[model samples]
Target chain A: MAYSNKVLDHYQHPRNVGSLDKDAADVGTGIVGAPECGDVMKLQIKVDESGRIVDAKFKTYGCGSAIASSSLATEWLKGTTVDEAMAIRNTQIVEELSLPPVKIHCSVLAEDAIKAAIADYQSKQERLREAGAPES
Target chain B: MRHVLLRLIDPFETLGLPATMDLDAATLEARYLELSRTAHPDRNAEVESDAQVAMLARAAAINDAFRTLRDPWTRAQALCERLAPGVVAATAKLSPEFLAGAMELAEAVALAERDAAEALAERIRRALAAILADIRAALTHVDARSAARLLNEARYWQKAGADLRQKLRA
Candidate 1:
């Protein structure tokens, strides 16, 4: 099936396509791959001390739907709390992008990236807690 | 059984390999390419219809075998099938712990919103790696019984990995 207009637009010109400082306490990175489709995606987020996401970025090597989903997710994540960000549903992304049934998995990937980035931030906080330092 | 027998008679024998799982993929692929070049239907345009059909069947089998052996998870499954035919009926059972872990991961993915995709993907990736490592270590054992169970577990993890990967891509 042909891609939705929104998905095509995002695929043609993605947004927030960059990286964050890996060494930074607030930065979280996630990478995932699908062997069946031979697709890979990397997502990153920068968060502030109050668990507020300041920025998001992604790099995905896959089909048009996958790229569009990542691009849309990155754009949606800015200036949101980690908790709020984690609550962003795949359904919303799919609806917004008007993705076809076959491409629903692409939206799911975007949701996965959000959780991975938050988990990374949480792990970092846990490490800081163990080290007796202020948590980011 | 018929498929196996037909495969053996028509294509597997031609590839010069036993029905066992220890076949080398690179050798098989190279041989497949060489054979396809010689007997390919495209090259035999003036050949009889029966000859073309036979070539097509052999070519398809070669491709199937090459693909099956190229992937470690599928290769392991095929090995189990060859070592103990019909064992798949009983071996499809997944351990409760594995099932639970997969369910938890699936739930995490389901709850994850668009913004948290990266964090969820990272967690799932780490979990999948650990599962794969366990399966790989289990496969190294020589015992047939244990190896069968391990192979089954490997298959489980392979499916789980695919699911997680889809979620990350979604």
Candidate 2:
């Protein structure tokens, strides 16, 4: 299928295409795979003390549409609150990318990656908070 | 002919074979050839035009069934889907560690020298063999969930292996 201009642009020049310190207390990493097409996507977000995503990155091994979807996701994640990031939907990505019906799953994979990353970040914070809490 | 053309038939049903993972290749081939000969549209040239259309559709469907069943991987996939409808849509939840490792393997393949890529490709092949065995066992037991999961994993390894081989060829 022919990719839209936006999809092609993100694919050719993907933004935030790398990794953060996954072990860091503030960084949340999410790795997801699409079973239909055997596509794998890893999306990570680093939240600051105020819970705003300060940075995002990703590495995807799949088709151009998958890469573009993740790349667009990371771009959206940065500067958004974790809750805001969670609200990001696959439909928005589809609209922005003009992905065909067949490639809609690629956008869904990206949405799952975003939620997974946010969930990881929240769980890490929960653990850190518990560790510093006063004894009952 | 009209009814046959209208309904969707699974590969096993189309080939008039038992829906089992342990299909005999020789038997499958024999069945496919026999079905193809009967389904060939040219043999229906003397029939009405609509009958010819049905014949053409049947011939195409037979070809598709053969293609889907000939490969062990796809055959297993078809069986799993037939046994557990909507299982394919569930998207098997692979572990995060496995996904991470797969990404790293893809990266390694991209950067590896010819010899290293070959080694990695061989490793993937071995892993695929084990997964295929597991899939066969799962299907034998009618464990659609396990079969679906294994098939999903197999697709990743298959793609990786193909990529590595292409790189080596380059």
Candidate 3:
């Protein structure tokens, strides 16, 4: 199936196509895979002191659609609050990328990656708060 | 007709083989040959056009079944689908740790040098063999869920292995 121009564009010149320090307290890392397709994706978000996502990066091993979905996800993640990022749905991605029905799972995987990253970040913060660490 | 339809869809049934992961190559080949002799479309060319068309379809199905049953990976997948319908869809959730490992392997392959890629491919091949053994055991124990999960993991390893091999070739 033919990929949309936007998907092709992101796939060729993916935004933030790398990784962040996963062990950092402020960085949340989400790694996900689609077993059926043998595809894996890693997404990370660095949250600032005010809970705003300051940076996002991703590396995906799959088809162009999967790469495009995560690339677009990182682009959308930056500058959004945690709640705003959580609200980013796969449907919006599908509409934006014009992904075919069969490729819809790629978007779902991207959405899952976003939620997983936020959850990781929140859990890390919770641990720091419990330890009585000074607010950064 | 119902029986024919069932045979057409199920590789084991089509090839008249038991749904076992440890299938014998010679036995499978013999079964294919025996079935092919009767189902070959050429044998139906002297019959009515409608009958010929039906035979052609059956021949195609038998060929498809042979192809699927010949590969251990595809055979196990077919068994999972047969023994536990909808299991593949329902059990699509893989463990996070496994996904992490897969991501790591994918990245490693992406960045490895030729010598490292060759070593990684060898390691992945060994990993695949181990996973296949586990899958076979799972199937033998009637643990369809474990079998399905192992098959899924094997797929990731296979992709990683393929990527490594491709890099080595480059």
Candidate 4:
């Protein structure tokens, strides 16, 4: 099936495509996949000490819809707190991108990516705390 | 649900052995070729349509069974010996830890580009292989419920591998 115009546009000229320094305590990374279509997405965020997202980036490999979903997620995540970013649902992403039913999983993958990144950040924070290091 | 009659005679049973998961691959392949010469669709083209259809179905079933049983993961799953009805529900719940690992690998793949991505992909590939091996080992001693959980975990890794492969292509 042909991708929606919005999907094609994002796929051709994706936004915020890069990685943060993973070793930085302020940066969180999330990755997700949908096995049914074999699509994978990675999302990263740089959060300030107050947990507000300072920057967002993503890379995705799949159909046009998957690329669009990750691009839209990264754009939506910037300037939001980690909590707000976590609450961004796949349904909202799908609605925003006008993704078709079959491609809905692409949006789900994007949502999962956000959660994964946040979780990773939390785990790192926990490790730092366990080590008696000052929190970033 | 549609009823499927298993009309293909059990050659292993006929040969005086129990239905087994541990068939020798080379012997099985040789036997399959021998059976195909007699029962394959191409060999039975002159037969009546209904007979030919039945023979073709039998041959196809044999091939399918052989293929499934030959693979390590699938064969381990088959050893559990539960019939088809429970297979779906039995293999659906993946562990949270496995999911987290998958998420980590996926993120790594996403950040890496071109050659760098390849290294990340290789790492994920190795991780997935290790997980699959663990699943197979677990399947050997676990009940249906636990085996299903392990199978789902394997499925997650398998999907992760597939996803990374797709990213490499992109």
TM-score of each: 0.53, 0.89, 0.88, 0.59
State the fraction of real interface contacts model 2 keeps.
0.75
Better of 2 and 3 by lDDT: 3
- Using TM-score as the yardstick, the better of models 1 and 2 is 2
* Best candidate (score: lDDT): 3
* Candidate 4 chain A weakest lDDT stretch, 10 residues: A31-40
Query: lDDT tens digits, residues B1-170, model 3?
Result: 32233333888988888889888999999999999999888776789989888888888889888888888888887887787865655677787788988988888888998667667888898999999899889888888888888888888998888777777777
The per-prediction CA RMSD against the true structure, in angstroms, equals: 12.7, 3.6, 3.5, 6.9
What residue runs in model 2 are displaced by over 4 Å at the alpha carbon?
A1-5, A130-136, B1-8
Q: On a 0 to 100 scale, what is the lDDT of residue A80 in model 1?
A: 85
Q: What DockQ does each listed candidate score?
A: 0.02, 0.76, 0.71, 0.12
Clashes (candidate 1)? 28
lDDT per residue (tens digit) for residues B1-170 in model 1: 43364323333455655544456777777877887788677888888999989888877767776666666655555555555554443554444344334434545555666678677667656755664455445445533344456555444344545655676677
Q: Distance (Å) between predicted and true CA of A85, model 2? A: 1.0
Chain A TM-score values, per prediction:
0.95, 0.95, 0.98, 0.94
Worst 10 residues of 1 chain B by lDDT: B2-11
**Candidate 3: where are CA atoms >4 Å away?**
A125-136, B1-8
Docking class for candidate 2: medium
User: Which one wins on DockQ?
Assistant: 2
Number of the candidate with higher TM-score, 1 or 4: 4
